[model samples]
Structures are given as C-alpha cells and as structure tokens.
Target: MSIISLSSGVQNNLSIMPRWPATQVLIDSLAWQKLQAVQASLPGHLGLILTRAYEPRVSELGRARTAFRRAGICLFGLLYRHRKEEIQDIFGSNGHDLDGTHIDVSFSINGQRVRLLPLSVFTPMSWQARRIKKFDEELSMVLAALLAQGFQLHRNATESLQIHCDLKPVL
Candidate 1:
C-alpha cells in the first residue's frame, strides 16, 4: 500500500480554482507517480490505472481494451463516488481504497467513455494532445481503437468527471 498526497499548492490552488492546464499538470504528475509505483511493485504485468466514469461502458470502453490486451495490462473502470466510506467498498480483491486517490476531470472526448474501475481509471497518458510534445503511440492507439469501433471525439458534455486509479497489482 502506498500513500498518495497532493501538494499543498495543488490542494489550496483548487480553492481559488486555477486554469485547466495548471490543474492538469498536478493530475498528470500524480498519475505518473502512481503508474511508476505500480510498475515498480509489479515487475512483469502492466499496472492498470482504474478511474470513475459517469456510466462506464462495457469495461475498457475505448480502444484501450485491445491495446491493454496487446500490452498485457488490465484496465478497470467504475462509477464515480465522493465519500471515502462509499469508495472503500468498491475495491477489487487485488487492492483497497486506492488510498483515496482520485482525479477529477471534465470528460473531453465525444462518443467516448473509458471504464476504469476501482472508482477511477486513467487513459489520458495518450488522450492529451500536449503529451506528444511531452511524451506515445498511446493516444493514436486509443483513438484508432475507438475509431475502429466507430466512436468519434466530438465535443460533448462539460460535466466535471472524476478519473480514479486503483493501485491494485494485477497480472
């Protein structure tokens, strides 16, 4: 079990509400950290970063399923929950509570939804256009996978969504 903490600046800045990019960096950093932790913990199998969705599709909704299958990683998705007690019950046999780790995001893509379980799962390591400037074959694969399924990334709802990751080690 690992402890996840948002920097005070990140926690407090949210009080005033910074711009999207600023908040994004914080989320990305935490996501990256958790990914690293999982990677280190489980040497061979790829770590699944599960997060919450409004009403997630048939698990691994986007092209991520095939991609994860090909890469040999598991992807889990679940509905969003706010309270710590409520979230505590959703854990897989693999892990628990995610140490209360959650990523709040405004779902950006249209006809698009990724079901990441354990309350929140992430696929954004590819979804962000800037990641190319910063990092994947990931985004393209996710998009292509979705396109193959006939889903388009048109602009849609602006509802604030939470992306959570369950640090459950899975093979």
Candidate 2:
C-alpha cells in the first residue's frame, strides 16, 4: 500500500486554488507515484489493463468476458457520487468528476480495499480526453452486454432483475 502526502505549500495553496504550472507539476508527480504503486501490485496474468471499453460486438464481448473471468477485483477511478453541476463548479467543465486537469487512478490499499487518488499533476488535456472517450465507450459496451443478456430498462422498477442461463448449449 502506498501513501502520498502533498507538501504544505501545495496543500495550503488551495485558497488560490489550482495555480497554473506549479500546481500542475505537483499533480503530475503525484499521479506518477500512484501509477507506480498500481503497477507494482498488478497480477502477472493481467498485465497493465487500462480502463477502456471493449466493442459491443460478439467477438469483443467474448474476449472481455474471458479477461474478466481472470480478474478477482476491478477498481476504477470513476467518481460517480458527485453531480455534474458540482464537477462543473470545481473544474469549469460539465463532464465526469475525473475530467478535471488532475488524473486519478484507483489506488489499492490492500487485497480488499481501494481508493481513487490523483494520478498526475497537470496532465495534458489530450490525455484526459482520450481516457474519457475510452471510459464512455466501455460503458456503452456494458449496456450492450446487459441488454444482450436479457436485461431491460425499467424507469422505476422496485424488484430486482435476475437472469439465469444454462450453459449446456455452449458447453
């Protein structure tokens, strides 16, 4: 488990809030450190799997399913709890919480715990843009898979949706 502490100056400078080049440097440095920690703990079989969407097609779905079968736990940097308005106010943008200048990755604390921590000091906007595209693409695949497996959109359904399949045919 890797822990990072920011310098007092950087931490205290929050009053001015996200001061250009200097703050960006610190953010990038922190991101690099966290990335190293994540790389150190990855399973041999998994290698470095960036959080990206697989295609919705059958072949891509099969490949994705196989990869997931080998994964025990998956941690993502998605900050879904915050509303879009809140994110816009903070970063002057109207997108996901992580679309800000700072890049954050899921930091694993132990075998069972994980937290989202900043990945980079002022990373390039292009990098952020590419990642967000991949993330959204992957989400689309998720929806595709859910619907392919017999799930439907329910506006306010109370009960849970349970899907069962007998593997005899595929086997």
Candidate 3:
C-alpha cells in the first residue's frame, strides 16, 4: 500500500490549536481506551494518526506515539483552534448549539482538505453516533487511514463540517 503523509507545516499547525474547554465528565477516557484497542488490532504495516479539534494531552500523545512506534505503525496528531466566526461563516449565523461540540480543526494533506461530517449528524442509530468526545482522535485516524489508502485532502466547504479530498490509486 502507498504510504500517506502530511506536510510538516500542517502537522505543526494542528499541534498548536487550543484545546476545548474541560467537560465535567471524563469522556475522553473511553475514547482513549478504544483508540488503544484499535491501535493494537491494526495490521503491523498500517500507520495511525490521531487528530483532534485541539491539542491532546501530552501523556496521551506520548502513549499513542510510543505504542504505534513499537508496532511499527507511524503515528501523529492533528489539532485546530476553534473560532466562532469561522463556524458562523461555515454553518451560518445561528449555528451554535447548546452542545459545545463544534468543528475546531481541519486537516490538509498535500494542499487538499478532507471532508469530515459528524457520524452522528449523518447516521440515525445511536451506535452510529459520532462521539464528539473523541472527534479529534477519531478524525486523526480516519485521515491517516485514508492517506494510507492513497487519498489526499481536497477542500474545505463554505458551509458545513465536511472536508473534501482527492483519492488516487497507489502506483
């Protein structure tokens, strides 16, 4: 399989994004455990990336990087700063909801943007719900896997959380 990669600059931009305000519940704990399980189950040759709306806890990032490294899977993190104006621009004037969950980051590979929709917003079943708690890490892995499968970020749409991408077959 072709290896997927992001430019160093994009990665850096993600690293500096502001983290979301703390929640009363420890939602990330479950997601982190799930990520660890997924990492453990992935093929030896597969790589992993952990993306989030904001920068991750240093310990979490360290653990992910170390675990993936030992398994010979490349790992990285992507984060973005959340901006209310940007959300208004994209989701329209009355887009804010009582739920704090919102788009805080965008991932670009080779100058292309990847479309990301909340799995919950699109799917009906609660099981299909996109866990906003794990949005960052989940997005990271999805983007990484897509890149590994030979896709690149395409564009950011004017309105909506969707990010578009171009896919190319591995030579």
Candidate 4:
C-alpha cells in the first residue's frame, strides 16, 4: 500500500475566524465544486482522517461521511480539535496541538493508507467567496499532483470521475 501526504499552507492574512458575506458567489458554487471534486476523487475504502483538528459540527461531519459513502468510499478516523484548556483533556502537549500540521482526513486504498491535510477552510461566509478560492486552488493542486504521479482520470457522466489504475484497490 502506497501512502501519500498532501501538504498545503493557508495565507496568514486569511482569518481563522471568518465573517462570510451574504453575496459571495465564489464561496458558494466554485468552492463547493472544488471540494466535491477532491472528495469524489478519493479512493473508496479510505478514511476521512483528520490531521489538524477543528470543532466540526456534527451535521457537517455526518454530511461528509454520507457523501463518502454515497461515493462508495469508507469513513475511517477523525482528528478532534481542542482549545488550550481542553488540550490537557486530549493531548498532553501544546506543541502537538499546533494547527494545520496533521491530517484532516485519512483513508486506505489498495491496502495503502492516505491522509488528507485539513488546509481547506470552512466557514459560513466562506460559503460566499474566500473559501471558494482556496478550495479551487487546493483542488487544482491536488489534481495536478495526482496526475504528476501517474494517476489517470476516468470520467463518468452518471457521477464524478472514476479513477482507474492497476494499483487501485477493490472496494
């Protein structure tokens, strides 16, 4: 099983606390499309493992899991977020809890495990513009990187692109 790690950095200017605008088309369609594309490209049987942690709403987690299942993928592990005070309740060290250093999602394909870094921003206003741009850039980079590694894209009009390769694991 081959393991791949994709790392990305967020702009320091981008606020973690987002105040999304109401009329941000960039956040709504393009960002969502990019996210969907990335999620869809993930191989089935891998987990949506979390690297950097965050307080994801239960609904959002459920939706993500549902989307994975619907796409014939398996949900595996999670990385939980903790505040400074809550750090002791989870991990013992502040250094270990640093943001954007871990996987936000993980999965196994063809017996190989992969982790998705949690660099994609999620916020209400991100539904408007900023998040969408980030999403597009990130997804594009992911696609290009995968292609560079010899992964080929398979188009499926009935659904998302179905990746095909001899190494692809059986779901």
lDDT (C-alpha, whole model) for all candidates = 0.28, 0.26, 0.33, 0.27
TM-score of each: 0.21, 0.19, 0.23, 0.21
lDDT of 2 by residue, 17-88 (tens): 121212221232333343334354443222221121112224544355345423411211133232323332
Candidate closest to the true structure, highest lDDT? 3
The better-scoring model by lDDT among 1 and 3 is 3
Error of 1 at 69 (Å): 34
Model 1: per-residue Cα lDDT at residue 94: 18
Candidate 1 per-residue C-alpha lDDT over 36-141 given as tens digits, one digit per residue, 9 for 90 to 100: 4433443232222223211112333323433433332222233222222332222221111122223322211222333322122232423333433332343344
Tell me the deviation in Å of residue 26 in model 3: 40
Of candidate 4, the 10-residue stretch with the lowest lDDT total is 157-166
lDDT of 3: 0.33
Give one digit per residue, the lDDT tens place, for model 3 in 1-171. 112222223231232122223221111332323333434544443323333312223546435533533442111111113332243233221211211112233443333443344331222223223432335564556556544544444333322234223334225
Estimate the lDDT of model 4.
Answer: 0.27
lDDT (C-alpha) at residue 55 in model 2: 22
| Winner by TM-score | 3
In candidate 1, where is summed lDDT lowest over 10 consecutive residues? 155-164
TM-score of 3: 0.23
Model 4 agreement with the true structure over 68-114: per-residue lDDT tens digits: 43332211112223222322322222111222111122223443432
- What does the lDDT read for residue 112 in candidate 1? 32
